[model samples]
Target: MRKKGFTLIELIISMAIIAILAAILVPNISSYIKKANNEKAKDIAAIVFSNSMRSYMKDGKFQREDVLNNINEDLNIKDNEVDVASLYDSEITVDFKVSKLEYEVKIDGEQSRYDFKQK
Candidate 1:
């Protein structure tokens, strides 16, 4: 004459297992999110660099204001999965060189730099 429901001990064990799994997964999930954001920032920065270079080639001059505007536009686009602009700590910096283009993207207080050499 035994019941078909789970015992109290079984329920407690299941709850404990769920809690342990959550503890293990939560931090990993957050870290992955941070990493993904960082990567997204990097991609945005690269695109900015590429667009600036193309504009420079087309116009025969590099405009800092235009580059900044492009950065804003790219980050604010509605198609983006994440609001990358919010993650940035400060305005992006672009440095134009005679034979190279350099840009820095700051996210979460870390700076990621990229260099593009002219061919």
Candidate 2:
């Protein structure tokens, strides 16, 4: 009588297929997760910057360090910067650039940039 269970060749083939599928999917899933995290980080950073800027305006002064500090405090980030340069951290480095009302943020090594203007 023929065996009811999978043969060695069939098992090997199934495993090979699974491995191929994982190889194809793992990288795409990883990239999507990284992109999602970066998006969330950027959104939080933007909100922090906006609120800090409003506070600075209301108080009739502008101090990048103070604003950054306050924003960090509010956001529970230990180290943050508001310079028109790179802000490095353990997992990512965020670069900030502002010219007049235009502002840009480059997160990590991604080419995608977030830009905004202050009114």
> For residues 1-119, what per-residue lDDT tens digits would candidate 2 score against the true structure?
87588889999999999999999999999898866656665566576555455544554443445556666666665452344333432112233322222234433323223354332
| TM-score computed on alpha carbons, candidate 1 | 0.55
Which parts of model 1 are misplaced by more than 4 Å?
Answer: 64-119
Report residue 91 deviation for candidate 1 (angstroms).
Answer: 13
Provide TM-scores for the models.
0.55, 0.55
Model 2: lDDT equals: 0.51
lDDT of 1 by residue, 1-119 (tens): 97799999999999999999999999999898866665655565577666555444554554545645565566563332212232222223343221122334332212233443222
**Residue pairs that clash (backbone atoms under 3 angstroms), model 1:** none
lDDT of 2 at 56: 47
Can you tell me which runs of candidate 2 are displaced by over 4 Å? 1-6, 80-119
The per-residue C-alpha lDDT of model 1 at residue 3 equals 75
